[model samples]
Each structure stands twice: as structure tokens, then as C-alpha cells.
Target: MSKSAIFTGLVIFIIIALFPFWINFGKTAPVPEPELVGKAKTAKKCVLDKMDMRANHMSLLDEWRDSVVRDANRIYTNTDGKEFAMSLSTGENSCLGCHEDKSKFCDKCHNYASVDPYCWECHTEPKEIK
Candidate 1:
């Protein structure tokens, strides 16, 4: 083949190989962010304050439990990513349902292994309120 013909063929091959990536790049629809309505922050604070005032550890952590449940339900429904590979706890229970009673459940494994969980980073501690 002539030199110009060979060059044109190579250029066409390269474009064809890269076409799929270029076609998919930034092609997804943009996700809409949640709109913050009036008094949303204040309403959340008031609800959390009421939970804190209830004097029960469970009530204090109820917000975190609800958040986890909602996230799990979303994952279960979507099943679009790797979430479909793992198991989710769907029952009406929180991680506290297992971790709080250390002597009974958590201690049996986590205590013996001397491992600390990152859960408390966001979730409330089950111990007496500090």
C-alpha cells in the first residue's frame, strides 16, 4: 500500500479502538442533588435533641439505625454494583443488636480478637452517655 494509504488506515484503526471509550465518557445523566428546603436543618436538630433527651441508648442511636436501613434498602433495590455480591441485614435490627451485649455476642469474637470496629465513628456508643 502507498504510505498515505497506510497512514490513513492506521488513523482509522486508532479512532475505531478509542471510539467506545469516547462514546461512554461523561455520557451518564447527571445526578440531581437534594434540595434543602426551609427549616430542614432546624427540624433535624430538634428531632435529634428529642431522641437524646429520651434517656434511652436505643433512642439516641435510632437516627443512625434508620440511616443504615435506608441505605441498605437502596442497595438491595439497585443491585447495580458490587452490593449485589454481599449479604445485607434486612430484619428490624441494628448493629447494636449484636455489639452492645459484648459479653453475650460481641465479646465472643471481637473481644477475643481484640479488634475495634469503626461503626462508632458515626453510630452512637451503646455505653452510658458520656
Candidate 2:
């Protein structure tokens, strides 16, 4: 009697908890695959490794910003001991240098993630040549 009642309550609780997952199981948006163009394709490198950049690029850029502005240090040495200019939208080793096409590379992932990064509030967005 009570055992059956408890079992039914447990089943009900689980169904309620997983209702959203069941409804949206196969309806998720596919992950964005940002395409590289220009220097990025040839260089095949970045200030950090690919996975690290994909996960924590914002944090890395923040550190670079603080270092350059506060300490006047404008160099970034990656794990491979390659040095880069700690810049956002300038220099050949900076973000925009390799990622020239903001629409193809940056916008795809940023939009897919629904992110409106404030980096463009001050930095000029690269002109889309096409």
C-alpha cells in the first residue's frame, strides 16, 4: 500500500525533473565551427593552443589588456615559447591580424553563443572587404 504509493511518488518526481530534457533532447542547436581565412590558414597557430583559445580567449585577452595598460608589457609568450604582440585589433600577431574576417571567424561562434562582447565598444570592427 504505502510502498506502492512511495514508488509512484518517486516515478512522478523523476518524470517532472527530466521533463525539459526529454522535450529538448534532440532540438539543440549545432555547435558553431568558425572558419579561418587569410593568415590564420597559413600560420596554423595562435597566441595559445586551439582548445585553450576556444575555451578561455576572453580571459587571455583580458590579461593581455591589463598587462599592456598597467605594466606596459606588450609581449605574450605562449606555451611553445613563441612571443606575440599583446594587442587586440592591431599587429600581425594580434587577434585581428590572424582573424581578419570578423564575420566568418568571430561572428559565427559569438552569435551561436549569443554573446555580445564589449570588445567592439572601443576597438574598431574590421571592415568587411567583400
Candidate 3:
């Protein structure tokens, strides 16, 4: 083929190959942040600060689990030296006491972040009658 025709064909090939990128350029919309639900909205406070809870909740839960099961320590002391029962199932001073609705508080964020926590698999979740 002639030089001009070859050059034009190459340019067309490149444009066609990158057509999808051009079409999608700057079209990305940010993912909508999941909202906190149920009692979490009105709760007096959380076990950890908002930012700490959001970042390290899984690790905290794991520590709680090990403390209760392996170390046989049933009482948890917060930063303020307030003690609470460390039972995950009973929902007394643990996670469920304040955030009673797992579907709302826990599951919403977990699903949004694509994390599948196995805590609910073995532990029976407290049922909300309403």
C-alpha cells in the first residue's frame, strides 16, 4: 500500500483500539457512601471512635473473640477504664447491645466494602421483632 494510506490505516486502527477508553474518559462517578443505620445513628457512643471503628473493626472483633475464647477473659475495659461483658451473643455490652440491627449497621457497611465476615456464621444473630 502507499505510505499515506498505510499511515491513515494505522491511525484509524489506534483510534478504534482506544475507542472504549475515550468514550469512558472522565465518566466515572464516585460510589455512593453507605449510610449508618438503626440504633447506631442515635447511640450515645461506640466502643471505639468513629474513625477507629471504621478502620479496625474487624481486627477489634478478632481481638475480642480471641480474648473471650482463648484467653477466657470475659470482661473488656475501654479507654475510659469502664468494663463491659465481652459476650458477642448476649448483646449486653458488646457490639449488638447498641447496634441491634445487624442488617442495618454491620451488613450494610460489610456489603458495601465487599467483606464477608464469618462472625454471623457461627454466632446466632439477635432477631429484631419489629
lDDT of each: 0.43, 0.87, 0.76
Question: In order, how many clashes per candidate?
Answer: 0, 0, 0
Root-mean-square deviation of candidate 1 = 19.3
What TM-score fits each model?
Answer: 0.25, 0.73, 0.66
Which digits, one per residue and each the tens of the lDDT, describe model 2 over residues 38-126? Answer: 99988887877889888999999899999999999998888889888899888677888888888888889899888999998888855
Candidate 1 lDDT over residue span 55-121, tens digit each: 4534434544565466653322222222221121222223332233334543354444565655456
Q: Is candidate 1 or candidate 2 better by TM-score?
A: 2
Show pairs that collide, candidate 3: none
RMSD (CA, Å), each prediction? 19.3, 4.8, 5.3
User: Which residue runs does candidate 1 get wrong by more than 4 Å?
Assistant: 1-92, 98-100
| 13-113 per-residue lDDT for model 3 (tens digits) | 99999999999898984654545556666765577778987898788878888998899998888897877777665855667765676776677767767
After superposing all C-alphas onto the true structure, candidate 2 shows an RMSD in angstroms of: 4.8
Pick the lDDT winner. 2
Estimate the TM-score for candidate 1.
Answer: 0.25
Native-to-model Cα distance after best TM-score fit, residue 40 in candidate 1, in Å: 36
TM-score of 3: 0.66
Ranking by lDDT: 2, 3, 1
